[model samples]
Target: MKDENIKTAARLLLGTGLIFAGISHLTFARKDFKAQVPDWVPLKIDDTVVYSGIAEITLGGALVLAPKKYKATTGKIAAAFFTAIFPGNISQYVNKRSAFGLDTDGKRFARLFFQPVLVYWALKSTGNVK
Candidate 1:
């Protein structure tokens, strides 16, 4: 298949998958994910987990249904969001705990590093995006 098609498929898969995941996390991982929140952060409000879940769902929707614009804008946004969340993954690893049912060990740490790659892959599939 063509690269664009591949990228689109990947974007759709990742985006839609994350949306579902956010829904699940919002519905189920609420208390668990909240407990795992790092202590160094000062704003330990009770709403962050659900808010973050909403953000994830929004991002996933944008990625899945992005209109043609500034070359791979959606992919770039998705990638950046993954980068932003990298620290949370690290916290999970350090605490040896799972967040949102995601594994949290050596394997999880490794997976944490790949989210950026997924974003890049989706962008690169477009072949014309920067």
Candidate 2:
């Protein structure tokens, strides 16, 4: 069906985006990513960034390569991952640590709203929602 096809495309795009982001976290954007790590987190900021980068890469791979029967499970995991990382976004805003062009409080605050959209996208694209 047309709807299914659309979902498929969206899922692929999300997966690819995640992969790209993960790469950035480990490489070119590593310092920018550290800006998002909350001070309360115990790990060294660089370590946190690296670990999260790996997680993102794994989740992205799962989203792209998960079999049809496992799509919903992958979706749930992806959604949870998105939820887990939300605090980093909050940290970026609260600490006034600018990254990804969210240089102002208003922009950082607005970026907070996008996390839920990613959650929804993960679920919907994998057919975990109608």
Candidate 3:
């Protein structure tokens, strides 16, 4: 496969993940997903999680289904989408909650630390950053 095709496939995978996660959050596991939100947050926790989930799924669908002609924009949207949800990852660690049965203190930072790399990947592939 060409480099562009490979990048497109990876972008699709990112979108796929968001779609699956959003579906889970909007469907059967919203409360569990919200459990990670810190009490200090001002908004209604349930509303926040559910809304975020919906947004994620919508953006994910856009990314995955986006035509090859729109890969650049779609990738940027996916990258920004991922960046936005990152705080939830932090909330999970702070609340001592597991996201998908893999939640643990040691594992928390391990995953959280990759925010930069994810961001970079998103930027480089999507042309958001040099």
The residue ranges of model 1 lying beyond 4 angstroms of the native Cα positions read: 99-104, 125-130
lDDT of 3 by residue, 34-102 (tens): 866677778899888888888878878887786767767876776776687678778888778876664
- In model 3, state the lDDT of residue 91: 82
Q: Give a tens-digit lDDT track for model 2, residues 22-96.
A: 999999999999999999999999999999999999889988998899999999999999999999999999999
Please report the candidate that would top lDDT against the real structure. Answer: 2
Model 3 lowest lDDT segment of ten: 121-130
TM-score of each: 0.77, 0.98, 0.79
Rank list by TM-score: 2, 3, 1
Against the correct fold, how does model 3 do in TM-score?
A: 0.79
Off by over 4 Å in 3: 124-130
lDDT (Cα, tens digit) per residue for candidate 1, span 1-130: 5766876777778788779867865886677666446666566535666777888899888877667674377667677777766666677778777655566476657766776676676566434354
TM-score for candidate 1, please give it. 0.77
Please list the C-alpha lDDT of all candidates, in the order they appear: 0.69, 0.95, 0.75
